[model samples]
Target: MADPTLSRRHLFQASAGLAAALLPARAQAKARLGDDGLYTEDWYVDSFLDLPEDFAAARGKGRGFALQWSQRGCIYCKELHTAYFADPAIETPIREAFDIVHLDLFGAREVTFLDGARLTEKALGQRERIRATPTFQFFAEVDGKPKEVARMPGLLPRPEFSALFRYVAEGAYAREPFDAWLGKQGKG
Candidate 1:
């Protein structure tokens, strides 16, 4: 006759091993940092930090401009890049619809705002009153000025995030609030 205690211990050990095996992929999926100590991605648009030019280029391609603000040591930013943005469902639509530009929240790199104001990334963040990492500012050209159509101040779940890209891509921001549009889609 087998000891019940021993059998239970074995079962527990197996379950623990299985859980441990599943943890690595997610735990190890930390975003890769560049030499500048910023997370790097090939998909991010390499720009001269000229917002007007970037907006025009994106419009020329029939897309909108997406500015993604991140900072070093921001876990939310890391999670967004590693988990949410990495999702195929989210990446596909964003790649197709927006010219995504990455901005370091505290970076010293010079940027020319759409209104022709020159400032460093840090100054721009200050001017924009960005209080969170991973803030997304979406823009559309209106009357020759790049107007902010929508702004997301923090990380959104995959469904909402994907919907955001579609919302901007479809020019729905001009007609309705994101929450209203999301509600119509039964996501609210």
Candidate 2:
């Protein structure tokens, strides 16, 4: 007869070995932290926090302005960077279609609105009624001013996020609401 103790020991050892083998992969799935303890990416556009100028610049580059509002210690932001933005399929379209700028939800950095209003990043978020981290504000030029065309208030799944890039890039927001457009594309 087989020894029950030996069988249990073998099972435990195998489970431990499998977990050890998966450690690197689990680590790799985590987002890399910046000096400020927030996730960072090299391709995000560096700007002077001027919305009008940034919008014009993005248009000049054939892209829209994407303001990403985040806060430190936001797990959703980390997931957005690590899981969604890290995917080449999603990142490539976003990089091609939008000039992304990061804004801290509670930071004191100065920001100039398109209407010539100046406020701190935190104040701006308050003025905009942004109550959540990882909010994405997409803008397009409307009559020489940067107008907010769409807003994603929270983290979207990978497919929806990718579809968002496509919808904006294709100028579908001008014709219909994002939900309608998304539904038309069978991605809603």
Candidate 3:
């Protein structure tokens, strides 16, 4: 008296469940190694290297715009993609609130600046005075155009990193210094 169709449905469901169970419990990739030899996050913005357009798109999403400057063979860059971002408490808010564009500190790919200057990534790095890998350039709209507002020269440990991102999100730089704000938040 058992319905064959019902039995088949249960078998299929069980098969699917078993397949899932057979897979690795921690199958998620922490980071991807790009062709450029840099490690990157899955959530980083993909773009045409147009700074103005990228900024506009990020603004449209109601998110902050940031440029992540890194280089090939940079150990700190690897840690940024792996360890720092692995912390949900650190990554969640920042990932949700910012549109991060990754750039190579020493790359040949062309990038168009907000000022309409088209240059290679290496040139842009020089123009921006970038002397270190894993620098973060935070931009804000000023006079109806994207302008760099904050620059973090290198990586910070978890709490400070979290606080820095929060500081940018809160627009706290206009009101006070980062150290002062960090102290106020009890994270300095």
Q: Tens-digit lDDT track for model 3 on 129-171? A: 9988799999988778788878888898778988888899888
What clash pairs does model 3 have?
Answer: none
Candidate 1 C-alpha lDDT tens digits along 135-170:
999998777678999988998877887888889889
Ranking by TM-score: 3, 1, 2
Better of 1 and 3 by TM-score: 3
Top TM-score prediction, candidate number? 3
In model 1, the clashing pairs are none
Top model number, lDDT? 3
Per-residue CA lDDT of candidate 2, range 112-178, in tens? 9877899999999999888887999888877766788888888888888788778877888889998
Show model 2 residue runs off by greater than 4 Å: 1-32, 186-188
Worst 10 residues of 3 by lDDT: 22-31
Model 2 deviation from the true structure expressed as Cα RMSD, one decimal place: 11.1
Off by over 4 Å in 3: 1-28
lDDT, candidate 1, equals: 0.84
Q: Rank the candidates by lDDT, best first.
A: 3, 1, 2
